[model samples]
Target chain A: MFLFFLSSGMFLGWSLGANDASNVFGTAVGSRMLRFRTAAILCCVFVILGSVISGAGATHTLGKLGAVNAVAGAFVVAFSAAMSVYLMTLARYPVSTSQAIVGAIIGWNLFSGSPTDSNALSKIIITWIVCPILSGIIAVISYKVVSVFILKRKIHMFRLDEMTRYGLVLMGAFGAFALGANNIANVVGVFLPVSPFGYIELFGDFCVSPAQQLFFLGSLAISVGVITYSKRVMDTVGSGIFKLSPVMALVAVWAHSVVLFLFASQRLEQLLLDLGLPTLPLVPVSSSQAIVGAVVGMGLLKGRHNIRWRTVGGIAGSWVTTPIFACLISFICLFILQNVFQQTVYLP
Target chain B: MAFISIFKNRTGIESEIDSFLNLASESGLIFMQGIDAYLLNNLDSFSEHLSHIVETEKEADTLRRSIEDLLYRKTLIPESRGDVLELIERMDALLGRFKGVMFRIEIERPNINSQFHTGLKSLSNCVIEAVESATLSLRSYFKDISQASDHIHKVAFWETEADKASTSLQKAIFNNNELGLDLKMQLRDLVRSIDKIADHAEDLADTLAIYVIKRSL
Candidate 1:
């Protein structure tokens, strides 16, 4: 029964991997620079590291988004988010897992009569839009800088090719680590209220917290998804609307990882506070959108001939609909999971 | 010694350029064979040699196009791309000039005085030397750029000799009273056509020298 309940979070994890994981190495693999096997191996290793070490920062902010309050409710909320993501994906929408999870949590707050924090909800929604634009801008700058600095050098084409491939592998590893640290909240934050695992001592000295244990499990599901299902998404993203040159692909993914890290880094938030500066709001941003925006940014810089407008519109349309549909789905699924099945989904 | 990468065989530009270079060399060889077939008046061999040169020229063209597509798709060497492209185009012209001279000899069947035969053969040798030195300079440019200057000088010397020999051959054709006035002009045009082969090689050597200097800096 514990395994059965945990499967919903795993399903959400799988959805995250199937969609978000592609953003990390999609272009590298798609452009056939680094082989897919090398990409997957690097992604798995760094994702596990990021989840184990830095995954705690985003969970607190996600808790502020709205706590699920009960294990059964957590399962239903996660299931609903997973369902929304799965459905949107089948409809060929580039939906955000971050958005769906937040919407489901909001659905929980509404269903249980808890006061919804409109401020927190709005912050997340705004980030969903802002993160992509910021990445795109950064990409435009990176393209100009790299072109002026590196491409202008009288370098051999093969030397440049070799360097770019190595750069992608390194950048891809960083992107995976950032994705795990920032987005692990969506996978296991709901389960935090009813976490089952106790602290386990490892290496005889270090204590692995219950939260880390849950995150580890969640990351495992994400790895499974990466290993099994994300290949097609990688191929699509790699070969899609924007034809990326090596440098453009590198700039885009690196910019995305930087943005995700900036938003999700608790230490950076504290540093900003200490410096009396405005802290970047800690939120789970969409990896898919950040990468898409970066690609679009490169396309615009290359003169808009390559940007597939239909693809851009389809993804933008999904951003608005995904959350609304997830809210409805979670509201309905939680109600059924609670009343029809006679399950104690909520404290009330 | 050139800096080599293992990844180029898969789709590396260095390997592709190397193959292009190899094809360029083969076209030069077949150009000689076509001349020989024409000189011997072996029509059957001449047709085969003509067809072979045509086929090699087409393959070289196809290889050049493939390399250009890859370069545009990624533009790995944006700085030297124009120079590299110009070099390939110039090298390709050697075969083009060879084919043109062969076609003239086969179709016009000019009744050349035997004295001009030695001049044509010597001019052909000089054309071959110019092409060979130009190709060597190209290889040395990619391999050990500093040594490229010596090969460039050799290409320049051979090109000068070719220009001088072809001019003398034209003068000889015109001086012969037995040949028709129209025939003298046609043979002069033929010598000029062959002269263009060395001119293209000289052009490539000059471009390569400048390209290597830019790269070395």
Candidate 2:
């Protein structure tokens, strides 16, 4: 029964992998700088590694927002978020799983009569707005530094192409790792409170925790999605959206990875705290938003005229509409599950 | 291991490109020598230089095709591959032009008066210098794009010098009442054909300038 209820989260994981993997490796593959097979294999390997090792940070923050204590409730929340993403995508609006999942969790909170943690909610909201801006700033600075460095070095043309190809592959790996660490929460965070897995003892001193087991399972679904469905998304995002040079593509991906890492890295947070500095809230930020932010930043650096305000406005509008759509869908679905099917969706 | 292969492939292609450009430059020198031998009435030496230029041009064409094949096969330098291939083809065409002039000189075997020998030699020198500058610009384009402009500008300067030389030589031919009109026309045609090589070089330089701008980071 627990496995049955967990299928929705796995489905959500598949969707996230299908969409977000493109964000990491699309430009490299699209520009013919790297092969699709190479990109996908590296993405799958590092995503699972990141999930097993570092996925907890953002999931903890998401659990704080609203911990749906029932497995059935978690299932409904995941399903609702997935539905909202599908609907928003069909509507030709930009959709983010992070925003949709957060809104669905809030709906679960309202239905269950649990108090929403205003602090966590506010932190997630603020990060949504800050994520893109921060990524854009990083991209501009990195591109300027890299371009100037290349100019000064005067590397031969073929040699420079070779170096850029290597750089793209390396950065794509990092971005995949970061994506898995940061966004695994959006895929399976709701199930954390009700995970059925128990800690398994490996060696006398080594053990795999229940959370790591759950994350590993979730990441496997993501890996399957990358293998089966990510190629088309990667191709379109890489070449069809806007043409990016291999170098600019590298900078954009690196910037996006860095921002995701900033939000998801507990070690970084602890390091900041140790230094008596403020830390960024560990949250699942949108990978698509980060990439868009990086591209926009490069456009701004090139010139203001290079940016298309109409497209920016459309994407911004979807950010607001997506959450609202998910929230309403969650409320309606939970009510039906409680009243018509006579299933318990809330502890109360 | 992949890293080692990448470096190896790059080094091989780099040396290939350098060798190809050297062949183009060598043909220019051989063209000048061919003209000098023809003026000095050394038919055997002229034939020797002509054979050497034909071999150089053939070698350049083969090298260029190999580079183009390797570039596509490896899918190296995707962004600038088209531009690079176009540049190689144009340079090769310039080399063939040098060979063509040598063949024309050999086939016509124009009767040259001693009066026009110095003028023809001067015109050949100017044409060779123009081609040399064009080849150097292409070399700079591959090695260091910033240095490309340094040599690109010189192609036009040499081309202008060649134009002046060709004009003065043509004037000298037409003014000589001792020569028949048919001979004068033949000499003028030869001067113009030589001058056309410099014109082609200048056009190539213009194309390189645009490619450089496109390649600018």
Candidate 3:
């Protein structure tokens, strides 16, 4: 029964992997700088490592937004979010798994008569708005610096091509790890409170917590999605949306990885606090949004006419609609799971 | 280990491209020597220069094929591969034209009057300079795109000089009443043939300018 309930979260994980892995490796693969197999293998290994090592920070934030204490309720929340994402994808609008999962958790809080922590809700919302803007700024600066360096160096064209290939591979690895660390919460955060797994003792004093184990499972599902289903999406995003040269592609991936790392790295947060500086809130921000922001930043740097405003407007519209759809689906589904199936959805 | 191999291959390919361009320039020099020897009635030197150019063209063709193979096999420069390949092939065709004109002179062995020798030599010199400028522009395109425009404009300059030399030589041939119409026409054809090499070089220079612009970061 626990496995049955965890399947929904795994499905959500799979969906996230299928869609978001493209943000990291799409341009590399699409531009033929890196093969799809090479990218998928690196992405899978690094994503799992990231989820198990640093996934707790974002999950903690999601837990604050709403703690669904029942395993069945967690299943319903994940399922609703996945359904909304699927529907949105079918409608051909850009969707963010982070947004859908957040809205679904709030729906569970409302259904269970648990007050959603307004502070956590506000922080998460604000982070969503700030994530893309920060990514764009980083991308613009990085692109300018790299362009100037290449020009000043007067590197041979073939040498530059080889260097860009290696850069894409390295940045793709970082982007995959950051994606796992940041977005794993959207896959299994709701299940943390009602986890059925036990902690594992490693070496003499080392231990793997239950949350880590749950995250490992979710990340494995994501890895499977990457290996099996991400190639087509990577190809599409790499070539269709924005025609990026390999250098621009590297900049976009670098900016996306750095933004995800900033939002998800607990060590960075602690270091900022120790330095008496304000820390960014740890949250699951959309990889797709970060990539899009980076691409747009590069386009803007080149010229305003380079951007397709209609595509940007359509993506922004989906951001508003995805969460609302997930919320409604979660509320109705939770009602059926509770009364119709005769299950207790909340301790209260 | 893989990265080291890429580095080694990159250096090898870079030098190979340099050698190929050098061969193109070398062939132009040999073509000018062959034309000068023919006008001076030095059959032995003319034949020697012709064989040297023929060998140079063969060497360039072989080098070009190897470079194209390496580029495609290794998948380097995915974005600019087509442009680079086109540039190399067009330059090779230009070298072939040099060889073709040399062969024409070898076969026709036109009896050139001493009075026309200076005009023919001057025209050949101008055409070779235009080709040399085109080669320099191509080299700059690979090493420093900023310097490419500097060499590209010079190709046009040399091409105009060649046009002036060819026009004056044709006028000299047509004005000489001692020469038959057939001989005048033959000499005019030779002059135009040499002039056309410069025209081809100018066209390549224009294409390279566009490629340099495309290559800018």
Top-DockQ structure, candidate number? 3
Residue range A1-348, candidate 3, lDDT tens digits: 778888898988887777778889987887787879989999999999999998887543346687777778878888988887767555444467878888888889889889988887888789778988899899999998998998889988888888998899778888888778877887887677778789799887899999999999999999997898777667656765566788988888889889888987889999999999999998767777788788778778878776767766766787788889888899999999889999877778
Listed models, DockQ each? 0.15, 0.68, 0.73
User: Cα RMSD for candidate 2?
Assistant: 3.0
DockQ of 3: 0.73
Cα-lDDT of candidate 2 = 0.84
Q: How much is the lDDT of residue B186 in candidate 2?
A: 91
Can you list the residue pairs that collide in candidate 2? none
* Candidate 3 global TM-score: 0.91
The digit string of per-residue lDDT tens for model 3 on B83-163 reads: 999999989999999999999888998888999888888888888999899999999888888899999999999999999
Better of 2 and 3 by TM-score: 3
Clashing pairs in 1: none
What C-alpha lDDT does candidate 3 achieve relative to the native structure?
Answer: 0.85
TM-score of each: 0.71, 0.90, 0.91
Would you list the C-alpha lDDT of every candidate in the order shown? 0.78, 0.84, 0.85
Candidate 1: lDDT over CA atoms?
Answer: 0.78
Tens digits of lDDT, candidate 1, B133-180: 988888776555667899999999999999899988988887788888
* CA lDDT, candidate 1, residue A242: 73
Per-residue alpha-carbon lDDT of candidate 1 for residues A86-175, written as tens digits (9 for 90 to 100): 776665455688788778878888888877788988888789889989989988998788766653564454566667777888889888
Positional deviation of residue B202's Cα in model 3 after best superposition, in angstroms: 1.3
DockQ score for model 2: 0.68
* Candidate 2 chain B, poorest ten consecutive residues by summed lDDT: B1-10
